[model samples]
Target: MQHRFLLGTRKGLFVVERTVHGWRSLPPHFPGLQIPAVLTDPRDGAWYAVVHHGHFGTKLHRSADSGRTWTEIASPAFPPKPADAPDIRCPMRGVTIPWSVELAWCLEAGGDDQTGRLWCGTVPGGLFKSDDHGDSWSLVTGLWNRPERAKWFGGGYDYPGIHSILVDPRDPTRLGVGVSCGGYWVSEDDGATWANRSDGMRAAYLPPDQADDPDTQDPHRISRCLAEPDVLWCQHHNGIFRSTDDGLSWKAVPPPEPSGFGFAVAAHPIDPETALFAPAEADVCRIPKAGRFVLTRTRDGGKGFETLTRGLPLDEAYDLVYRHGIDTDATGNRVAVGSTSGGVWVSEDGGDGWMPLPVRFPPVLTVRFV
Candidate 1:
């Protein structure tokens, strides 16, 4: 079977196809527009892409024939400011803030049985839902109107955004989302109501006593095991974390060697005990730890992690993998990783080994197998 990979980059979106011989590249779809997120619906083979224009704002596009063509769709927008809407204040710092929706940070396909249903997470931290595929979208007001949102702050950007959305495969009504600088949230009733589930996560940048505060926790990225939705893996701002109760609570997981701080994490499609992470230095410097590139895999959950570096750069290499830049296929054996420096690599045997794709493109924002 042929494998298809979608590479979202700052300049556009590229399609990488792999055959028995090797990998082949297709022309970029949205040339010059920043493509932060893209997903292919397995239910009907529809493709979705998030296109962000600096001055024109962000938009969503869909393609039925893979990446050959696309149609722009209605994008998520914040509701008109209410007359009584008060300026939001940082919960911990007590600073008045002006928050507005600026971009769609992530896109996710719903459960296998929920055809045409889609989920979107956006900057300024809003969750949206679409029952008619990408044609129309509505803000999940239950999450937006939460009182806890008033305290959320941005981890990298000026405003916190939900960059990870996980729809429980076992139950379509259950959902989870991760926000930068904010915390993790779960909804058991199809997003009608939300609650913070970041119990054990920490925010090292905050006061020592405030480190464990849910609102102060920064979850860079979160991934769930397809085989066991209750198991989740997170690459947090301070370190790695794992949760066995569907994100109700989390525990710190030490990375293999250099550091545990990184942006991306991917769970094995079939094994709840396996996962992959791309490690980088802490917030002070986002390069590969100690100037060496490696991918760490844990087959026994967080009990132990092994570093996989063969076929990867060994010295003087500085590549930062974004939160959505690493992904594994349904088989759980094929893994693809993209770097912010326009480098791409693929591993057919899980994280055991890797091979670089022949050509380089723009700064990659995300990578996924369709």
Candidate 2:
């Protein structure tokens, strides 16, 4: 079977197909909108894309017949400001938190049998749920009303966002979400309620006393081991983390080498012990360490990591991989990565080797294999 890739880019979305001969890039889809997230639901072959338009706002599109056509669906939005609701304030910074729905930062489909269920994470840090595909959405008020939200801050944007959503394949009601600067949260009874699972995680920017504060921990990205749903991995702002009991608690994993900061993390589909990360310089720099592009892989959970750079640029190359810009196939042997510089690479035999897909599209935001 030919491996297919759906690349969400800053300018649009592109589909790249890989066969025995090599990789081929197909035409772009949703030509001018910035696509921050895209997902092709294998259960029913439904495609969903999150489009961000600077002038108009964020919108969701659904494609029933692959990417050949699409239909605009109800975009997720914040509830109307309550007349008696008080202004949100940031407890740590002593400032009023600007509350508004900016964009859909992440899109995740529900379980294989739950066709109409969809979960979306948005800027200003709100989680929304849709039971009819993308037709309409309702704010997950349980999480939105959490008291800890007063402490969540933005890591890169003006406000924090739920950029990673993981729906446990074994239970349709179980869900996990990773927020930038807000940390991690897990729900056992669907979106009815959430619990902060940032314990043991650290935030370097904070003082020593507040380093382990759950609300202050910034998780750049989080992924779960497909073969072992209880095992979770996170590329944290300060370092890497892993959780064996779902997201109840996280343990810091020694970051591999040059720098520990990064925004993307991926787990092998069939191996709970294997994971991938693209380390970059500190947040201030946001560039590859030493100007070299390399991917660090860990075969024994986070015990140790090996830097893979066989076919990657060695010098003067600074490519940043976003939180959703890396993914692996079902076999766990095929991995694909897209960078902010529009660079795309694939590793066929795990992370031991690599090959570049002959296409430089827009600044890549997310990449997925179907």
Tally clashing residue pairs in candidate 1. Answer: 1
Worst 10 residues of 2 by lDDT: 90-99
Query: How does each model score on lDDT?
Result: 0.88, 0.87
Off by over 4 Å in 1: 90-99
lDDT of 1 by residue, 81-172 (tens): 78887788766556654456688999988877877889999987889999899788888989988888887887767777899999998888
Best-fitting candidate, scored by lDDT: 1
Q: Residue by residue across 1-370, what tens digits does model 2's lDDT show?
A: 2289899999998988875688888889988789998888877889999999989999899999988899999999888878876777665566666566788999888887776899999988999999899899999999999988888887767777899999998997999899887889989999898999888898879988888889878899999998899999999988899999898888999879767788899988788999999989877888998899999999998899899889988788889998998998888788899999999998888878889877777999999987
For candidate 2, the TM-score is: 0.97
- Residue pairs with backbone atoms closer than 3 Å in model 1 (clashes): 91-151
Q: What is model 1's C-alpha RMSD?
A: 1.5
